[model samples]
Target: MSKLDSSMRCHAPVPLAASHDRNARRTLWVVILTAVMMVGEIVAGYITGSMALLADGFHMATHAGALGVTAAAYAYAKHHAESGRYSFGTGKVGDLAGFTSALILGLVAIGIGVESVVRLVHPEKVDFGDATFVAVLGLIVNIVSAILLSGDHNHGPGGDHGHAHADHDHDHAQAHGHAHHGHHHAHGHDNNMRSAYIHVLADALTSVLAIGALLAGRYLGWVWLDPAMGVVGALVIAHWSHGLLRDTAGILLDRSDAQLAGRLSAAIEGAGDVTITDLHVWPIGAGCHAAIVTVASTPILSAEVIRTRAVGIKGIRHLTIECAGPA
Candidate 1:
């Protein structure tokens, strides 16, 4: 048999688990603090009878729900530290959690929009003094929450830095080859937060809009504008929700392989140390993916060889390589 390709040499092992845990912990704290604040906002809105405050409260609830998922992800990761059921560990649990949260957020957006529209049709006289006070309080809360989330390293689309950071015995070069696997977790969480952020922003905007509407309705007697503001807020949130749902559904269904194709192919071609022909890739779960490659080389390269070479390419794990026709 032909000798193993010299270019197929191994590199230092990467630390994926430890890093992953750190991020999970960070996310847990962020979500926990935000959830607590969300509950408070909901109660405040009810007591004050402020539409804008209620709207902001609704947005906070979604964030709290999303954060709950983030906490679950952290728990799963901690529990399943090393299980054969997950070939790549439970790193992608974060992504799955985020995706679920996104879907929930989208539904919440739709519900809020519908209710806002109804209230618009039958406008209520809002206590501007009370509503304004509550709205301002909500704005401060959201800003502080956002600031806390941003200060952490895990608040990104990539695991840590730009991919999943986990403690594994795998070689650094090998893990680098599949860096794409790490991104799903980050991407999912980012979507969840983004949905929450949009909701909060909309809340803030609605308050400002309501101020104008309230003044016109109370003084100028332009009642129609109040409902118009509601309609506008509903429309804006609905649009944001649609995008979040589409993206999350795509992730849940494992439909984001196209974007992964080019990157994996390039990594394999560079690392495989062999001429590449046909390379196919698909996501298996969050922060994990599988690939199949057909290469033209002197002899057939084993799956292990290709996998070792492809490890560090970003988002790749559990790779399969096959030898094609004569070189």
Candidate 2:
């Protein structure tokens, strides 16, 4: 039996703690700012006896809560990155947070939809002066929050440093008769951050709608437009929430990327005459994937040769290749 008889494990390097910490601190700041604004809105709403102000205030509160979740998740993931309990580290913690936040967003949308429907059925007198001011304030806050959260910062589950080096090592080892394969997958931005950003944007959208509704009602006497705008904002929020849910849920469920799988199969088959008996590919972190390939190939086609050929494929950071009997 060749040295390749044993199963090979190639796991990608975990994301850096510094990146997670940076994002966590950013989210923490947002949470604090949002909470303070939420309290102010709620208090002012109560004093003014404006349902619009009160509703916007409560909406701000939900965003604060969701941002809190994002902050906590980043902190936890950073703290536990090296823990042995998590087989693949704690990279998925952010995804879990994103999933939960998305659920909250969906609930908020539903609540807005319901309230808007009720208001549409029976219009009420809106305190345009007070509500418009508060709505404008909320919009400014949301815009500021969005700016704070938005940027080209790469705070995702995978880091770029050392990825090329790692892949090179596999290439060097293959030359020395060692079988190894490593591919770095490029993952999208942090979903948790995206969720947080979307929350602020959604709030901002509501604020805009509120302002428009109030203005029209105050000057143009189109009171019904207020609730109608609410419905539109709710639909937008719900759409965003649904997408977030789908993405995070797919990650949590270990759903395979079909394109990635196809690339892997092609790489392996292109190497030599081999029949893939079984293959499993799953996401282990934000943009990192681990794969297991079982193949039946000619006895002369060593596992090292197969692995060497597949190493060029991107986004497969970790791989295990099992070679069985000859075809």
Error at 82, model 2, angstroms: 0.7
Clashes of each: 37, 1
Q: Write the per-residue lDDT of candidate 1 for residues 209-253, one digit (tens) a residue.
A: 766777777678887777677667667656665665665566556
Best by lDDT: 2
CA RMSD of all predictions: 7.0, 4.6
Per-residue lDDT of model 2, residues 133-198, tens digit only: 988998888888877776635432221221211132222212222233333333544778778878
> Where is model 2 more than 4 Å wrong at Cα?
1-13, 16-19, 153-187
TM-scores, each model vs. reference? 0.66, 0.86
Error of 2 at 117 (Å): 0.6
* CA lDDT scores, all candidates in order: 0.55, 0.74
